[model samples]
Target: MLITKGYFYNRESHVNCQALKDAWVTLLSRYHWDWFCTFTFRGEILHPEKASKTFDTLLCKINRALFGR
Candidate 1:
């Protein structure tokens, strides 16, 4: 089963970062029984460096939440 949620965030837009994080955590946890999982982000990232850092941080948060790391 594939679950999808969309949110737009940019310099001109307001988005709840924590809410987005929580949603991803919940989705991943709820589907923990699956043997494999993949996540894809399709959009243009204006700042590659900043986006990379954010992505790394989010991945760490997810890992800690799901694996107790």
Candidate 2:
């Protein structure tokens, strides 16, 4: 399924980073969706490398764990 948070993330002020991160982890753990995607618009990233590790690397890890490839 195609899940997106672009609308909700239109502005950084509208987001709670920790809560959003927790939600993503919780939902992903609770559901076995075939595939997914996430995004955010231009904004000041507090920690770019850490954000990548949390999102990009985590997604890749999930995909690998599920698909075994």
Query: What are the lDDT scores of the predictions, listed in order?
Result: 0.69, 0.68
Model 2, residue 11: displacement in angstroms? 15
Best by TM-score: 1
Clashing residue pairs for model 1: none
Candidate 1 has its poorest 10 consecutive residues by lDDT at 1-10
TM-score of 2: 0.30
User: For model 1, how does the per-residue alpha-carbon lDDT over 1-69 read when each residue is reduced to its tens digit?
Assistant: 222345546667655666778978988887647466464566854477776787898989989999995
Per-candidate Cα RMSD to the true structure, in Å, reads 13.5, 12.4
Error at 54, model 1, angstroms: 0.2
- Residue-wise C-alpha lDDT for candidate 2, range 1-69, written one tens digit per residue: 222563235433455566777898998798788967776635766477767766777779989999998
Model 1 / residue 3 / CA error / Å: 28
Residue-level error in angstroms, candidate 2, position 48: 3.2
- Give the CA lDDT, 0 to 100, for residue 59 in model 1: 84
